[model samples]
Target: MATYSRNRLTQLLPFILSLLLLGLNSGQVQAAPKAELWPLWQPTVATGQSAVPDFKHWENFLSQYVRRYADGLNRVDYASVTPADKAQLKALLEQLSTTDPRGWGPATQKTFWINTYNLAVVSLVLDHYPLDSIRDIRLSFSSLFNGGPWEDKTLSVTGQELSLNDIEHRILRPIWPDRRLHFALNCASVGCPNLATQIYRVETLDQQLDAAEQDFLRNNRAVLWQPGSNTLQLSSIFNWYQVDFAANENQLLDYLQQQGAVSPGILSTPDLKISYDYNWNLNTDS
Candidate 1:
């Protein structure tokens, strides 16, 4: 009888472990910041000549430091950044901080915020250089679980102090509510969508966004299918912001199919299992 009991426990271990992992992943998804609109950002003007701010400095910076590798990742040469280049980055951030984007159109505002988020990430990573991952630079004890400097107020935009979370969750997500924007904002992490070498412009914003989404989806990091196991693996971005993508798992598969990111045959398999994962290693040109 004792031998039978021991065998039963052994048989149940894998199932038990799977349940625990699912719970942990679910907790992380639940812990992701929700989109909450800040009222002050709602106002916008009908017409303005100087609505779009200059991105020449940003363009120059990107040209100098950002490099796109054959692996479909745009990595920054963070270690090679000189003091002068760092000052230029700081100048760009300062320019963005004082510029009031509320007076601009949504397209311009969207582009601005996306660039701001990506730039801020690079800046933060540089400040705490020689780290294995962005997750290593903890702002507080809670950061161990909360993750990096995302929660700390790192930028002042139009007199309103904002964090990376504020830019992504509060302003960008709430204002746009487009899943494609997820591909546009880079977190200086390997699992994140590639940081564009070219600056996002008002004229090409729509095309740029569409291209970003398509590019990310095509990469194995975003979606992978296991034919033998009939399992579908997706980036944790889809899991974290599921509402932005689809209403349910089936809808998500449909969405992927519509994007031409996944093959219909694989998505149509009977009783297919889905999994989510993300890598947080620093996206640096080593």
Candidate 2:
């Protein structure tokens, strides 16, 4: 009986350990308090992609409203936007709503989604301007928990409503799986990747994405080396999306090195520990 039990235990150990790891990864072990989902994600289809989205209006909006600071932070002046400009913004959104992204090429698809997600966020913030941060704008009565505007699906497109999370997690990340997007999607927060000052064009999508990645990697928010303690601290993004970054710490380091964000000297250090951190404060113009 003892011999039989020992063999059974060994056989099940791997499966049991895998379950435990999965649970931990899913945040079941120490789950953060998340706001309740108002309405769950619904399936939506992109229209057949044909014409390139004319981002002229979006470009004008960015040039007029977004201010770039010396620290690489871009802030949108939601308060200062005139009524006529807002109309243009609305019309631009409406154009996107009517356009189908189904048959678009990868570049066109990515540009459309990224721009749509960003514009939707801006429109949300503008709807309730004068707030310190985007997190302050919560659903009716859901403000008790400090829930943000992300869950609210305020735009209708392709016969379905869309939210910031839906456009990002559901469509962009799942479809593209590009970690560089972590730097492209702005959360109207200082901790998030800086909002691009210019509009994203399908023609220059690769260059734009590469530039964004390089800029973020060099930023202190994404990486830090504490020579005093021999510790390398990475952005919480790597922690949250480790699979997208790499399979292990060494591979992550290699990725950073390849991006020219880190040096061989940092990689050569022994007995180093890794930690992750993020900031959630609003990225507003003071």
Candidate 2 lDDT over 168-208, as tens digits, reads 77777776778888888887877677888898887788899
lDDT of each: 0.84, 0.73
Instruction: For residues 55-171, write the lDDT of model 1, one tens digit per residue.
Output: 787788788899988988888899999988888888878776667888777787888888888888888888899887887777865554566677888788887888899999889
Clashes of each: 0, 2
Cα error, residue 34 of model 2, in Å, equals 15
Worst 10 residues of 2 by lDDT: 28-37
Best by lDDT: 1
lDDT (Cα, 0-100) at 68 in candidate 1? 88
Give me the candidate number with maximum TM-score: 1
